[model samples]
Target: MGKIESLDFIELGNHPEKLVASSKQDLYTLCYPSEKMPVPSHYADFVRNDTVMLNNFRSFVAHRPFHWAWFLRLLKIRGLDESFLEVPGELSYSLQNPCIVAIPHFGLHMLVPHVLGHFIRQDSMVLATGNEEGEGVQDSIEKILPNDRTRFLKLPDRWILRKLMRGYQSSHYPVIYPDVTSSGDKRFRHLSFLETSIRVPLGVENLSRLCKCPVLPVAMTYHDDCYRLHLGPTLVYKEEGSIIFPLFSWIEELVHLYPDQWFGWNFLHEMIGEAKLLR
Candidate 1:
């Protein structure tokens, strides 16, 4: 945990279109998951090299099984913390003040707040799914985290979670991902990601309003043999609606830069209604 650096891992930023050529094997394991697909002529370079494919796969938070998740879980149970931490000085201050860190479900994201827990004095909690009356999701994630510091709420059950937010003597940073669309609830806001309007949950946005704090879009990925953190613009809450465009754009950029690390690309089209249309 020291001075972190910008992503210098791959050349994806210079030529984002190369993803159309990702290796079939790599795409099968990393992005496409379920079955092997014919790689287009253009995307082959994205996952052609064995080293590049595996390295990018290791950077993601979710895994097919034993590859990424189990290894990290073993490390956590053995008391091994993150390889590093990086956030702007002012961003740390915003954490101290009431603020929401809207993390997208990209890369090794679940561990960010857990890593921050070691450095910051303030209490922190990860807001996950509140199903099973907030018990099921909490159990699954809390087991992997450094401590039992996760909360489960339907997220729309705003008043109860709001009270907990108010009680934070210091900032009890509640981390939540807004890009999920596994559910068909109309409560989820519509957002554009890669020319697709996807259903995104507005839990973080509502929580920010309840706490009257600004939202910062944050992302984490392991690369160059270390952890790399990415920060998007801080959005002040507004009555009009959720500040999702900027955050969605940021994730879109990261997804382009690290296409293999984002697991949702398969179901992403479905979430955006593109899959159904094709049918």
Candidate 2:
């Protein structure tokens, strides 16, 4: 297996008790702040209280095993089936026409390729940041998924960028997570997220402009014993300015709708620290 720098890999087959313990500790460290920040008036409804926060934390912990199980299935260690995924028919067009697919770091995000593989006929690339914590699951994904079908490229590699440009020209779908705290290029914009400003990378918009491809906002959620992939309207690039705001606005809606499934909530405070607050 090839290694990408600063990319940590998750050790599979951990004891259930250990997983729970680690997850609880991580939840406490990241999600529970020592000092609670003031919630903006409009953002109050989206804020999670102690009980809801605990529930969300529990949901986050519970999903890890399922993610590992899905990875096992992908690696052929366990039997795999399509019944576990629910994809919308609307995704057919996007799959057919190569576009930049922007997905949030939501529930079971690494399983995206496996779930969409059944529908995607052309090769696709999944762009991930090398610096983000808890992104070790990506290493498992790279090892399991065949490179020819879906290539996992950690950003900041000039060679990969060249390949991505060529791939887009050839109709290969490039999937990216735009809501990350940091990007490979270190380019970011502090935009309004849940009524508070947090750093969002400009990679997605930059790539879309460079490739001249429309951005397809996709959201993945886990519920009812399956994963659901929802496709939003395609966003075309504008010559005048940045699309990061509108793009993230759509993401905020999804995060609000499925707060428990969103992994961002864990480190959200850190992302928002000292950044400009939205009025």
**Top lDDT model:** 2
Candidate 2, residue 81: how far the Cα is off, in Å: 4.9
User: Cα deviation of 175 in candidate 1 (Å)?
Assistant: 2.0
Put down candidate 2 lDDT per residue, 1-279, tens digits, no spaces: 311111123443222223323432332333323133333322324553455554554645554554445434433432245466566777776777677877777776656654555456645544333433334555555444434255555644655546666778876777777776344546677777776778766777878889988888887777645667877778888862356878888777887687766766555655676443321
Candidate 1 global lDDT:
0.51
**Minimal lDDT window, size 10, model 2:** 1-10
In order of appearance, the predictions have TM-scores of: 0.61, 0.70
Write candidate 1's Cα lDDT for 141-218 as tens digits: 454442645455554443644544663434565566667632233466777666656777665666667777777777
Query: Where does model 2 exceed 4 Å of error?
Result: 1-50, 71-82, 123-148, 156-161, 240-242, 274-279
Worst 10 residues of 1 by lDDT: 1-10
